[model samples]
Target: MTGTTPTAWQQRIDTLLHALADARRDAAAAQAREVALLAEAVEIAQAMAQDAGGPTSVADIPMRSLAAQIGAAARVSDRTVQKHMSDAVVLVERFPATFATWAAGDISRGHVRVVVDAGVGIDDNAARAVFEDAALEVARRETPGRLKPAARLLATRLHLVPLQERHTAAATKREVWVRDLDDGMAELIAILPAAIAHGIRDRLDQYARRVIDARDTTDTRPTDARRISEVRADVFADLLLTGHASPDVSNDAIPADEAIIARVQVTVPALTAVGADDTPAELIGKGPIDTATALRLAGTATGWDRVLTHPVTGTVLAIDRYRPSDHLKRTLRVRDEHCRFPGCRIPTYRSDIDHTTAREHDGPTELTNLAHLCRRHHTLKHHSAWRVRQTPDGILHWTSPTGRHYPEHPARTLVFTTEQAGADIQTGAVSESATASDPPPS
Candidate 1:
């Protein structure tokens, strides 16, 4: 082979990269344009409703046939099209600035998604304008996963209703439902409060870890090997079905290790912690929780952390998780909010802190060499042809088997603006403003 083969491959890669960029921009623009078309469809439905002397309200748009017609032309699901039409009305009307950004290709459809999800809580047009300006500015630079925290915080700030009040109202809507999956399996879905839900998951995870770790040491012969996920599922089922993790066929009850408890992080502002403010306390990887719930958890918590973060950048300036577990781990958890694999959003609490360089290669157990990786990605890194390196700044530069490079960054990549914190709207102001507005949830 000629020495020019490497040069040829480089040129091909450059071509692919450029094409991918163009395609992404085109796709975003297409999505932006879809909003307008969907808006027009809704308008047509409204006109039909008005002409027939029928209910002309948005919810009563009677878009079943309209959506079906559109769906036929677009070869999409009528139900999905109806849902999109509802969401489109919101984007095109309520968040024109954000829509424009997507149209201009400054961000992707995923960015719009997070913004829309967060925007629904605003319920006021002017407040949403402020939110859009702050969020869109940050959304332009960061990935959708990184944008979520900023978006959520902006949504919380812009709401006129007190978080506790809204949370209480929202809580009323919580219930569990089941959906059928393939192969005679069903997915048990629980729509619970953030704190409770996350706590349940954490507890299951801790139990799963204990079971997996003790597999080799325990004298009892295990039924079958299982991954952490499988163990967690099995434990959940066992607890729900028989009131314990493992049922004793010999009338023996296994001792519960109360010390192996779940630890959930509740990140509240110093003011909020002391009841000086009512701002929502975050459930870390989960979204905001009510102040009452936060206090309850904090009151009973065994450990405490004094985390100092940059107000504007949201950077972790310093943190002390207080637990004897490696301080490096606590710091890494705060820094790497999720797995340091491109596009992966698995929370760091459920992930492994991996050495970017193998420890066998004399990699130090320090910040630069350490980052969180979900078991899937960690296994892929070790078993597949993928390779990764971490920069001192906590960027994970991963090279695929095909030699494609994807750069993963720390979760704090979200940029915060003064508007995100409700500085623009003054007290008792948000509700009074933005009286007239638009849109529907996706």
Candidate 2:
């Protein structure tokens, strides 16, 4: 029998497989290049250490100058350069086998990183070598995620100190930290004992369920429900701020009618608010939230404002278009979402609505004349060589000091429609359509 020609689908599959293999090979080669760079950094650090008349140990090396040199050369942060230098030293001197594997394209940088992290605290050279030897095999066979836990387990068993003593030492390091994020958001991180952390998470989950139950049974609004994740977050905040689990009810010691209302600005579609549509709502500082959460928030709102937008484009169609007033400010706040400067994510609530053209230069007090800018960027606009212009569609164009130009459009929530949903199912293509509109700023 004659050999069969490959089908079109089979040829496509072959092409895809070849492409995937090429990508993997390229990634491995990149990892090898990184290892080389790290080796160079280690040498440079060692030389700096010697020049400083420090001890022969890599740990004693003056990292500040070394990091500065590496950072300038690599165009990376000094902290990043320092981390790379440290990782390189470990790979070159301590985890030789793992490094060899990574250099040879047999394993990735992630695998090497796992081996290094796992071998921490193993001071004895022989023990470290043993740990690396065991980890290398797992790295070759398993994903980084699986290899990490296995390597960690091996290190724990090989550690010379008792586990209880390690636990006691670690307990002293337990702490909490807060990090400010863009869009007026923040992250609260807690480092606690595993059992205690899990207990906190579990309790939050339970309270979230209760909140969900209360909303489903008692709240009649369409947008009042929240995702489990949102509910858990709310519960966590409540516990931290007021020692309460639910925002709708006070603690057992406080009266039920005295429940403190949580105040947040959410812009929901009129159709969604009245149960005609389920479009997602935009939380002023937090971006888009599910319709249920929006409804729940709206239900507790003490005041309401009606903003209209174009049906198809979702652009704000109606605003106090007459002058620079509070109404125009509110419209700009809802429209811009965040600072209009390129790459600046300061939320509108914390930003200033500034005129693109100077008022002294005869700039009109019109919707198209305004843009939201964070305080920092606002000052930069007036004092530096940065220039800004706004288009009729409310898109802002920025020209930097170096003449680099950037275009920024208002942030809009995504609305999933029935037609789009069906198209996604049939063609495996999901489309994102803007769900909100902004009026031009005065």
Whose lDDT is greatest here?
1
Candidate of highest TM-score:
1
- Model 2 RMSD, rounded to 1 decimal: 22.4
Put down candidate 2 lDDT per residue, 25-57, tens digits, no spaces.
Answer: 678878767767877867876677778784456
lDDT of residue 16 for candidate 1: 88
Worst 10 residues of 2 by lDDT: 413-422
TM per candidate: 0.75, 0.48
C-alpha positional error of residue 439 in candidate 2 after TM-score superposition, expressed in Å: 55
In candidate 1, what are the lDDT values of residues 312-336, reduced to their tens digit?
A: 5555555664344466776777777
